[model samples]
Structure formats: structure tokens, C-alpha cells
Target chain A: MSDLRSGSNLEKVLKAGHFAFTGECGPPKGANLEHLKEKFMPLKDIVDAVNITDNQTAVVRMSSWAASTILIQNGLEPNFQMVCRDRNRLAIQSDILGVYAMGVRNMLCLSGDHQSFGNHPQAKNVYDIDSMQLIALVKKMRDEGKFMNDEEIDGPPRLFIGAASNPFADPFEFRVYRLAMKIAAGADFIQTQCIYNMKKFREFMKMAVDMGLHEKCHILAGVTPMKSVGMAQYMAKSVPGMDVPEALIQRLRDAGKGKVAEEGIKFAIEQIEEFKEMEGVAGVHLMAIEWEHRVPEIAERAGMLPRPKI
Target chain B: MIVANPKPISEILDMIKDLKKILILGCKGCVTVCNVGGAKEVGILASTLKIARIKGGNPVDITERTLERQCDPEYIAQVKDIVHDFDGVISMACGVGPQFLSEAYPKQRFFPAVDTTFFGGAVQHGIWAERCAGCGTCIIHYFDGMCPIARCSKSLMNGPCGGSAGGKCEISKDVDCIWDMIVRKKMEQGRLDDLVRFKPSKDWRTARDGGPRRSIREELVI
Candidate 1:
């Protein structure tokens, strides 16, 4: 029998040996379920699991947990995300139990954007524990059935744990070791920052593969399809911790006016094709972002449609 | 060293609005070094408070005193004799000044005139930046002499946290990304391996997490 730890469809797909494909969604800034569902409806059958980002970009939005529960109600599996930015450990543990009780099975841990970068710059931040510690804490609760205080949990949530990695982030040589640390801290899988610097990513994967990181945890490459030349330039110049090479930017510019979106999709398709064969890459995580409407076509054109059912 | 900024004059005036007389106590400690509180500042504050009170049509008596160090019990004790004369003492030092004064003269109310900010040193003349968090343990050597606990907006032990851009923190262009500096320094020295190694989850028990930390020196104990 397959381990099927969380019983998450994403876990089932990955364990079943079919290359996994995941999609991302941002909860509406308010409790507008209609807007949230509009984004999810198109992605329901297209990807293995729909990842609901937690206050993405540190901007206040509908809670990722609430969105994930709503996704479950909409008949879609949710990969709920948690950030160690606004909550302390006590709240974090309680929410994990609460989300699990509400039927959420997959969880992504992240060190959220500092509160200073958000709408509430004046707000006090509570990092109580970082994402690395969060991964270990969750793993402990799931595997040992114990809390941070060592008290036993009556029924531990068996979660398929995930984490975010940015291979392009600084101290370039240390990115792989950081991945290893996350895995050691009990991350079962990782979905990295958006893929653009293929050469750097290839080198990063080489190091990860040499360390046999693939054998320890599933690695998913993050793919964001650029919407315009402006978006590419913004990401290349302003967006922190991302590496968008000049060649890709020039390619988008060369696509000429009105054709950037398709050109962007084409670039994403190319990256996905490369990820399919890349060593140590088990899948592609398409973060369609505010551009959720384009996911169905992107997945279809990329031939990832009809998500593998476990 | 401690770093602090003076509270707005309007706020301080509001704090003692009902009082007839008060003392503006300054500290010749970190606050003096930061140019926030000192003997010279005490004269300026005493004059300003008197002027504000006179302008309000309510003349009031004021005393100006600068303690060598408001954090020390000996310096706080020097004002014990005259504390009974004033309705309250406005401490122009860091939060510690008021706290120490309050502890020494429990009957006399001490209002902090300055907000205690952080433990830091001046980066340039008239420009001070935080450098330490007094977490009770020092790990600066591990991070290329940079204190992430006090510098990084997130206090990440292992991070640039995906929000670093153009060598500046996501908080603002003014806050230099300490991780960037650490990385650049290490990489320059061909010591990238130092950063790649795992820095274990901090034992915060010794940090503020343990709550109200204290230090006792057995050998120096009288």
C-alpha cells in the first residue's frame, strides 16, 4: 500500500510516479468567496493541487486557511500555506490543528515577507520561529503526535508538509545547503521561487542532485508566466530575491506589442518542458498569480491537463 | 550602548500639564552620547518647559539636573533629597532612566521623556543605528560580525528571506541588507562554506523568550 500520509491528491500523484503539476491562487483581499472561486473553478481539474497563498507579498488578504477550506468546499484539494510572520507559535500550532480539523491536508511553510513590506508597515511582527523551525515543528506534531511543549496531541494532523525555496536568493552557493537543511527539518517537498535563471537553476539542481536531495524530498520548480514587458522589467529590477535574465526580458520585448502574454506563456512552456527532464526536479508548480484565468490554457498547451488521479 | 530618541515636546508637556513644578532629569550616559539628554540639553529643556508654561498663563517652577548615569543607583540617589519638592520627574534619558528613578524613589512619579529605542552605536555624526538586541548571547562572529537579530527586519538567523533587492532590505532603501553584506564578505574571502552550514534553531531560552533576563557576576559580587 502507498504511504499516502496526508491522503492529499498531490501526495498520491507524486507517489504514483506521474510528474506532478500544481497551481497557486491568492485569496481575495476581502472575504469575497465569489472572486476566490472564480479563480479556483478554472484550475480545479487542471493541476494536482491548488496552492492558496497566505497573505502573499505580505499584503493583507483573506486568510489562506479560510480560502483552502473554501477550495475544499468547491470540490478542489487545497495546499494551504502558512507564514511565520504575523503569528506566534501558539497561534501557529492551534491553526494547524484547526485547519486539519477542517479537512486541509497539505501545508506549505514560509517565512513571510516582513510586515514592513506590507500594508501594515507600522504593525508589530512576530517571527516566533522561522520557516525552517516551522517545518520541524509541524513534522514533530505529525510524526510524533506531540506539541512544541511535548504534550501529546489527541489526534495529530497527518499533513503532507511543503516549503518554499528561492534558488536565486543570495549567498548563491548556500542555497542548496539551505534546501538540505529544510529537508532535514522535515520538509517533504519544496516549491521554489519562480524560475527564470535557467543556467543558475541548472547549477543549483546539479548541487542538489549531487547531495542526493531528490532522494530525500520532492522538488517542484516554480513557474510564473510573465504578463507583459513591464512585468518582466519590474521583476528583473525591482522584485527582490528573483533572477530574471536579460535574454528572457529581451525575448519578451522582441515579441512586440499585444503579443507579450502569449510570448510569456511560450517562455513558461519552454521552462516547463525543460523542468520535465531536469535532474532532481520532480514537478512544476505554476503560480498563475493574479493571472489565474490563463492557467487552464497554459496547462492545456503545456499538456498537463486532466490531472493524474491517484 | 543604548539608543533612544526624545519624545515630542508637546507630548511631554501634556504628560505634566496639571503639575505645578517638575524636574527634567538628564543622563550623561548613552543618551548624552546620542545628544538626546545631557547637561546642555537639561538647560534647554528646563527653559523650554518654563517658556511653554508661561505661555499657557500658568507660571511653574522647574529644576534641571544631569546625572552622570541614570542607569546607576548612585546617580539616581543624588536626587533623593529634592524629589519631594517636585510633583514628578521627567526623565530625559532612555526608558531605563525613568525606571531606575522610579525604583529608587518609589513615592515620586518618574515620567520617561525619551522613548527607549535600541542598543546601537552611531554610524556617522548625528546618525545612530541599532547594532545589538541584548539577547544575552553573542553570535556576531558567525555572521561576519553582523547582528541579524538586531538588523534583519525578520531577525532571521539564516536568511536574506527572498525580499532582498539591490543590496537593500525590503523594509526600505535605507536599511542595508545585512545578509547581502555577510554573503559578499564571505564570498570575497572564499569562505562561502561558512554560510552554507546549518545554523541551528536559536536556543531562545537565553533570549527574551526566557523573559526578563538577568546577569550576576559571582566573582564581582560584594
Candidate 2:
């Protein structure tokens, strides 16, 4: 038994200096457990851990903790994500304890997308705590065995905490500093927003390295293989905080109609190749959202297959 | 100042539909400044309601009155003499006006004609923007005089959340991301360090989350 924070596979893989590969799976809108299991089955041994999103994009879905429990039952480690959009502090802390008890060892703290972007546009949001405060709350729960109110818990949730960073978001200079803040708040690992602008990402990573944030936390570069030119264009124009460079869109366009997806995968593979050597990049969080079936192939091509047994 | 918008004539008409006589009361305070429930608006509303009722084949007798400020007891007392003369009173002030009127004259039905929205000021001749949430504690000085509690969509203390882009909020292109403004202002002043410090979880007790709040200045009391 080696000394480790959470001792989860994701933590062990990163700790042992293996270029980690993680995947994301958004829970279904309805409780279709078999369908949900099928979506993540390909990633069981292909990646170190699978991130289960909590009402991703604020659209209602199966709860991340419940989905995480399902993954655990299926013999996979889950990076259970909790967003501050739906749950207040009371609900958040309670869910944290409940999920940990269900054998969840990894968690990702996020300030979820605003409710207006979700299926229920009129739904009231609960941001009783921001992502930064949430990070601190989880760390206190794990490290001190205490809740936000400083009450001692009989059993603490010793989990590997993760946070999300979007390097493409505006006031661009502040992005790195925000990453540092999350790390300071006690995030052990980070999975950034999906990257398309490698130049900007490199600059952002450079700043993180300069500030020594990479030394404190494992920074996982986010990768999402574009499936079509429309997907690339939509991400570029519609998605906030997404920097889908024109060059990547054109490359997808140039790869005639039938081959755009292959071009997209090629681009993602190229990115994975570069990220393997990029300073401050400890892993790649491949979010082939709704495109999970192709993840195994992408992982194999990126040379991340046969994940470390540690 | 408090900003409000007049409830639609259809809604106001529906409220007073059963009454033949009604008082269209206006406030000469925040509602007046926002051009919603001023003395002039009271007269217009009275005439409009009369036309709407007459066209609907049920004529209504409307008596227009504008108080100095319906939120104050003194102004509320002005309507006492004629309070019983009308079937109902339509307070064309903010939501507070109708409540105060109802409390002052429990027997008479006071209907709010305007929906009180927020503490804001007119940005232009016809535009109003929210500026304060009245969160009880004022921390704008920390962020170079901008309030995220009122402006940011999520009211995040340590934001611009991931949704901030090109100075606009994710909710709408028209709404400015207040955190963006705060961050840029701090950067321009070479005070970027001001925002680097973590803003801990807000004590929402200061705000309405603690429940309906009250303030009593000891010196002014009694």
C-alpha cells in the first residue's frame, strides 16, 4: 500500500507519473440504467476513471452520484461531479457524504452552467456556494473530517478532489490565476474545458507552470473529437468559453463530408500527442460526449491503451 | 432608487372588474421617478381603465389621487377621508404602495398596479438597470465599486464564471458580465491582486435568505 491522497486509480496513475487518460459520460435524461451502462462500457478499462457529469449544461439528467454508484457497481472508478447550480450548501454537503458512503472516491467540484441554458429555463438556481468555496468545503470535509460548519464527522469522505478550468474564457489573463485559486482551494486534479485552440492553451499552461500550479495539482487537458463541421461551427460560435480555432474548423471542412469525423479524431490524436509532452499537462480528459464508442479507438491511437494496472 | 414597471392594463382591469367605483392612487416617490406610477401616469391609467370598462359595456367611475409617497404613513392617511367612497382602490405605486394602503385601510381592497422590481436607476431616458441587491452587507468597495450580487447571473463572489465571454453574461448578450467589468477595472489599475484573494462562501444571512429582514436605527427610534 503506497501513501496516496485518495488511493483511487486516477490518483495512483497520476502519482506514479503515467500520462493519465480519463473519459466523461453524461448521465441520461431519464433512468435508463442499461443504456447508461452501455455508454460507459467501452471506457471500463480503456481509461483510468470516468467522469459522470451532474446535470451537465444545467439540463436535467440522472444524478451524477447515482450514476457514479452505477459505474462503481460495474467495476469502474467514477469521478463524481457535483455542480453548485442545483444544490444549496445543505444539499451539497449531504450529497457529498451520501456519495462517499456509496464507495465514490473521486469528486469534481464545478460551478455548473446557468439554469437558463438548461431544459428548464424557468428553474430557480441555487448557488449558495461558488465552485471556489465548494473546493474548500470538500477539502475541509476530507482533510479535517469536518463539515463547512466545522462539525466533526464520524467518518470523513477521503476523496480525490477535482476541479474544472476553462483556459479559453475571456479576460484571458485571469484564467491562469483562477486555476491557481482552485488549486489553493484544495483541488488535487483539474480537467479543463475541451481544448481546440492549442496556442492559447499552451500559453495558459505556461502561466500555470510558471506559477507552479502544475506542481500542486495534476492538470488534465480536455479533448473532445469533433464529429462534424456543424459541431465544430456550433462550438465555435455558440458555446461560451470555447475557443474553437478557425484552422481546426477548416481542416474538418477540408476533410470532405464523409471524412470530417476522421479528421476531427486525427486532430484530437495530434493534440493528445502534443499534450503528452506539454509542461503542466498530466493527462487528457477525453470528453467524447455522446461519442463514447469511439473513445477506445481514440485511446488506442493516442497510445493510451492498456491503462496502467496501478 | 427602487425601479418598477406598471402591471398590464388587462391585469389591472381584471382586478377591478367587479367594482363600479375605484380610486387610482399614485405615489410621488420611486415609482414616480421610474415613470411607472406618477401623478401623470395615474391620470392616464384612470382614463384608460374608464375606456376599457366602457367598451366592455360596464362603465367604471374612477377617482384619481396622487399621494406624496404611499410608503409613508402620512401620505397613506391622506386617502382615509375618501377611502370608503370607492368600491376598491388601485394603488398605481410599486408593490409596497398597495401593501401599505391595504394595511392602512383594512376594509378597502388595495390592488397593486405596478410590480416593484429592484433597486436600480434609469440608465437612459427609457432604460433601467439593476445595481444593488440590498444584500445588507456592501462589498462593492472590495471589487472597485461593482456589485456582483445584483449583476452576475449566479451572484458568484469569486466569478466571472466559465460562462463569461466578451464582457457579456451567458444569459443574455445585453446583460454585461459585472465580474468582467470588475476584473478589467482591477487590471487597469494594476490592482489585479485585489481579486486573487478567495472570496469565501457568502453569509446569505445578510440578504433575504435569512428571511424577511428589518433594520432599526437605535438613534432614530423613538
Q: Which candidate leads the pack in DockQ? A: 2
Query: Every model's DockQ, to 2 decimals?
Result: 0.50, 0.85
lDDT of 2 by residue, A1-310 (tens): 1468788999999999999999999999899998998899989899999999999888889999999999999999999999998999999999999999999999999989999988999998889999999999999999999989999988999899999999988889998988999999999999999999999999999999999999999999999999999999999999988899898899999999799999999999999999999998999999997999999999999999889997
Which 10 consecutive residues of model 2 chain B have the lowest summed lDDT? B187-196
When only the first chain is scored, the TM-scores of the models are 0.98, 0.99
Which runs of model 1 end up more than 4 angstroms from their true locations? B18-20, B50-61, B137-146, B181-200, B203-206, B209-222
- After superposition, candidate 2 runs with Cα above 4 Å error: none
Report the lDDT tens digits of candidate 1 across residue range A1-310: 2577788888988888778999999999898979998989889888989999888878999999999999998889999999999898899999999999999999999999887667887888888788888998999999999998899999999999999899987667767878888898889889999989999999999999999999888999999999999999998877778899999999999999999999999999999999999999999999987888889999888888778876
True contacts kept of each: 0.44, 0.78
Best by lDDT: 2
Clash pairs detected, candidate 2:
none
At residue B53, what lDDT does model 2 achieve? 92
